[model samples]
Target: MTSTIARPAPDATRRQDSAKPRRETRLRALDGLRLVAALMVAAYHYGGRGGAVTEAWGSSPKVQFPTLHAFFSYGCLGVQIFFVISGFVICMSGWGRPLRSFFASRASRLLPAYWAAVLLVTAVFALPVVAYEAVSPSDALVNLTMLQQPLGVDRVLGVCWTLWAEIRFYALFALCVVLPGANRRRVILFCALWMLAAAIAQGVDEPLLDLVLMPQYAPFFVGGIGLYLVHRDRRDAYAWGIVGVSWLIGQHYVVRELWRAPSPDAFSNRTSLGIVLVVTLGFVAVAAIALGWLNRLNWRWLTVAGALTYPFYLVHEHLGWVVIHALHRGLGLASAETFVLTVVSMLLLAWLLHRCVEKPLTPRLRAALSRTR
Candidate 1:
């Protein structure tokens, strides 16, 4: 006997909506943002206090070019932008992958190149020509583990301190992903609360808990997560508008003016707030421009720059230092000439590193690791 089967209720059918096909599109604006941020970081390293051309080059005075220095000093904000981007991208990419595979992919992408750079730097310092102090064993190990930032050791590769922070953020993000029911909204809310607590804690001279727990700087990463949600929901206009306005305002008022004053500590508090706001907004803007109606504006040069950024960042500062030393001894170039030479050399070296190292290793390593997995 044939029995009549009842159809499922509409509400029951609606509950299965979670199986809907999710959108997956590359945002070019993110590439542009990455390019800009990396350049800014290069500029800061090229133009700031540690960047001053040393006395080893005969009588040439240090190049303290006012405008360039001011712009480069703002490069620290670029690191913050990176933090946000990392949070958003990693969360999205690693969302449902097995924990082992997720970490393996991350390690494959970051470690090989990083280890190569570290070894090269180690050799550089070991050479008598470089005339730098030797790194201790503990420092080397810490740097290798990407834990030197928290330990407060002098950064192994000057700029590598940020990488440690990036790794820490990645680890924390992975932890969040493994938790039960950790949706986009929950991540955003957690990050928001963390940011507020961090802001409050920043003012305290000696806080009860150390910086890691509250991690006042975490909000920027949170902002990136927030950007992911906004983008996921397709609210492109509102996100870009806010980001554009906030960045322009912060760049003009705080970074360009107040923080540029003579005193080293001038506007420290204001600068902090401005950086957080600007980075948060900048991520939104980049995401909006990438995903919004403005996709046509995504330029190829920005993509190239973004692609090479990791190695460029690693090598640029050292290249500047090497140039200043050589020019001082060989040509006795003035600060202006030295500045010009340094800039030119940095670009050339960045391009070379990309071609010879990063580009080749990235895909090859990914493929090799995928096979192992």
Candidate 2:
């Protein structure tokens, strides 16, 4: 009798690769960056609560912190970082694929988990809390389609507002990818035109126009697309150089000066631009690191943390008020204690969501899609 050799199924290998931990990917640096962004968002919300405490009890003997308000202000930058990463990843993944397939794949991956989150939030907020609003069915339906951004509907789920931007970028980029002669030069030119339009709309004080056009954040996404092009062409040096330049722009211009401005209006005009530039640079740096131009940092914990980022982002912002209310009632905790507990809870909840929701669903979805194809 002859011994039989065993072979793995074709779909098994694909599933295994897709489901592998973040550590196995060459793109662990990107995941690390995602984790940082997620944490920054959580910090931002916690910081906001601190600001509220300072505002409510400014003269109270127990409220003696000067840095509390300042801490919450920078949390908004996390969204910019997220926009950059979304641009880069979507561009890279959709490159060379048919537009239909690209849209379908993205829809399949994003919509299921997102709709579930929306339902969960809607159900929990059926009765309004201070920060949480009860949404109408029509509003929720519009949000479910991810078209609320252009419609000027403030997000039903707070964190999902960013996802509206993300979905728009995917759609716009998909159109570009499908267009005739939509090569590098054309894509760049198109992005430049879009950026100019956005800037002009913002300058005119048309917040609705600006929101609809999403002008302020287009460059970071375009920059990500540019990075993808460079990577695809194997222009490693140029990619890293872009990364370095973006870092310098962000550090020297945005974070240092714009972030310090006292007026929100001035900061929006001057510093927000700088933040956008720096975030774009962040995308470049991530790309360079992924391509091995830069040595990887051995941050395994960060890698694991990054895996929980999407879920963290989903839960952290909306649940923040709930957490703060609970802490105020139960612990009678100071702002600092409240902040720490909120962050810890966000991380722990994110870890659970990753294990319980994302991990299980992603594989099954991918398998089902493969079989259907």
Candidate 3:
């Protein structure tokens, strides 16, 4: 009859409460943007420049969707969008937490869903596209770690490379999280130093340094972080300078990729490069959204679309490819029909993953992880 409930310490209560505005700033627009990015990636893998199977798929008269292919060709640009969004969201999530808390939160949010995705991918590819080759124990171990490529082993899924970049970003930001003083200023300084290191590495002709610094993609993440600062009413000359540097670097990266891209004999290299440059507008679009230029994007359906993004992204490419190949080969379906069917099937699978795996497991896993701490 004489029991008293313990309450959170005053400082801890303030820390938890102060995190609300950060959460409140979660725009439905960004979720819509995420969904758009995921769809773009799926489309890219189905018919865009990155998809190696496109030529064979398009050769058949029954499946030629020239218009659709053209639209999705620029879809790789979506990855840049995701990068920028990642910077913004990561900063928001880590704004007020201690380093360990931030790390735990990120791990809890990402790992369980990712592990499930890995298993799903393994199941889909179990029978093999060619004759079934057994997955080696070493490869399985590497895949389980999700650090296969960095460890000089093959990835379980090709798309998993982006997760490596994400890991690097998180690790780099953790340093800033652990630093003393204002989080916003610490982030700004981190961005500047990161870009400076990248510039120096490039100047010294040390490609390994470039790899470590990741100058090619750093611009988008830095730009996104800068935009968040601007959104938080912390914009100043220094912040703008960082954003400008990031934008310039991103512009250079876009041009570099275009230049290195093998130009088809059907079109001049200039024309091909120009087309790609136009697609780089995706970066601008993301920055605009962060800068409050697209504040009117509040659609509920888009929010739902956003919520499904991670699962959709995880399940889309290879699994869809499997379905496409199977339908085209066994069922004698047209490439067009197979493409449509593959997309539909992938969407249903994504929904199931979101509901059955992500939704049910994420909070429980987070709770369990908290107990460990």
Candidate 3, residues 35-90, lDDT tens digits: the string is 88878887777876533454335352213654565565666667877888888788
lDDT of 1 by residue, 88-117 (tens): 677566655555656767876676656666
The CA lDDT at 172 in model 3 is: 80
Which structure among the candidates has the greatest lDDT?
3
Candidate 2 residue lDDT tens string, 123-167: 767865444456887888788888786677757777777787887
Clashing pairs in 3: 63-336
Q: Residue-pair clashes per candidate, as listed?
A: 1, 0, 1
**lDDT score for residue 140 of model 3:** 61
Q: All models: lDDT?
A: 0.59, 0.61, 0.70
Ranking by TM-score: 3, 1, 2
True-vs-predicted CA distance for residue 354, candidate 3, Å: 1.2
Better of 1 and 2 by lDDT: 2
Q: Decide which is better by TM-score, 1 or 2.
A: 1
TM-scores, in order shown? 0.74, 0.71, 0.84
